[model samples]
Target: MQDALAAHPVWVIVVDYILGAIMWTLIGRAAMNIFLPEDSNFFFMRFFVRATDPVLRLFRPITPGFLIDFLVPIYVAWFFFMIRFYLMPWLLGYSVMGMLSFPLESEIAALLYQAFNR
Candidate 1:
C-alpha cells in the first residue's frame, strides 16, 4: 500500500512540466508584447506575465536578470519539458499530470473549451 502511493510524484512532474510550458508561453507573449505593436496589450498576455513573473524571478539569474533576454523562458520551458516527458515518465514511472490529476483535468478541460470555442 505504501509503495503503491510512491508513484504519485511521477504525475506531479508531468503537471509541473506543463506549467513550465505555460511559463515559457507567457514569456513568449511578453516578448511579443514588448516588441510587436499589435499584440502589446493582449489581455491574456498581460495576465501571463503577471502570473509568471514572480515564479520566473528565481530563474531570472539564468538570463542574467535582463528582461529582454529570451534565454530564460526558452530554457525554462525546455527544462520542464525534459523533466515532464522524458525524465518523469521514463525514469519516475508516471507523469506530472498523473500526480496533479485535479488541476490538470480542469486545465485540460479549459484548454479544450478554449480550443473548440474558436
Candidate 2:
C-alpha cells in the first residue's frame, strides 16, 4: 500500500508512457498512408501498419480529412486522457479535468460498455 501511494504522482513516468503510445500511433498512420498510395516495401510497412491498425480500424470507414478527420494524434491524446483520468487518478489523486470529463465520457463509455459488457 505504501509503495503504491508513493508511485502515484510521478510526472516523468506518466509522460513517457503517453508519449510511447503516441509514437506507436504515428508509426501506424504512416504505414497506412504508405500502403494506400502503392504497394512498396511491404516488409517494413507491415510492422507499423499492424501496430496501429487496431485503433485506426475503429475509425477506418470514415475518410481522412482536415482537422476533425486528422484523428490520429487526437486519438493518442484521448487515450492518454482516459488512462490518466479513469486509471491513474486513484493513485495520483484527483485530477480536475478528469473529474470534470468523467460524466461526459461516462455517457459515452457506458453506452459502449452496455453494448459490449455482456
Candidate 3:
C-alpha cells in the first residue's frame, strides 16, 4: 500500500483536491444562498451554484425539506469527506491498520484528510 501510494502520489493528490474543492464549493454555495438571492447573478455565487447544483439535486430527494434547507451542503460535504478520507484510502489497497499507520505526505491531501477523518 505504501509503495503504491509512493509510486503514484499524483493520483491520491488529485483525488483529494477534487473532493475537497467540491466539498468547499457546496459549503460556499450554501453560505452565499443565505444572504444572496438564489437567482443572484454574482459571479462567485453563480459559479458556486453551477458547480454544486447537480450534486445537491441528487441528494435532495433523500433528505427531508427541513434538513435540506440549511444542512444540505453539510451533508454533501460529509459525503465527500468520507470519500476522501476513508473510501479512497481503502480503495487504494490499504488495510484498516495500514490506513491508520500510513502518513499522508501530500500537504493538501493530508490537511483535508485530517479535517475529514477526525
**lDDT, candidates in the order shown:** 0.56, 0.51, 0.72
Q: Which one wins on TM-score? A: 3
**Which model scores highest in lDDT?**
3
Expressed as tens digits, the lDDT of each residue in 4-116 for candidate 2 is: 22544456344535544655455455546644532446655555556655656665555355544335645554555656565655554555443424333334566788899
Q: 1-118 in candidate 1: lDDT tens per residue? A: 1222353555664565466567557557547656554334777666666666665676666655554444555656566555555665566454444443433444566678889999
Worst-scoring 10-residue span by lDDT in model 1: 1-10
Arrange candidates by TM-score, descending.
3, 1, 2
**RMSD score of candidate 3 (Å):** 6.4
Is 2 or 3 the stronger prediction by lDDT? 3
RMSD (CA, Å), each prediction:
7.4, 14.6, 6.4
- Collision pairs in model 3: none
Q: How accurate is candidate 1 locally (lDDT)?
A: 0.56
Q: RMSD (Cα, Å) of candidate 1?
A: 7.4
C-alpha root-mean-square deviation, candidate 2: 14.6
The stretch of ten residues in a row with the least summed lDDT in candidate 3 is 96-105
Q: What global local distance difference test value does model 3 have?
A: 0.72
Candidate order by decreasing lDDT: 3, 1, 2
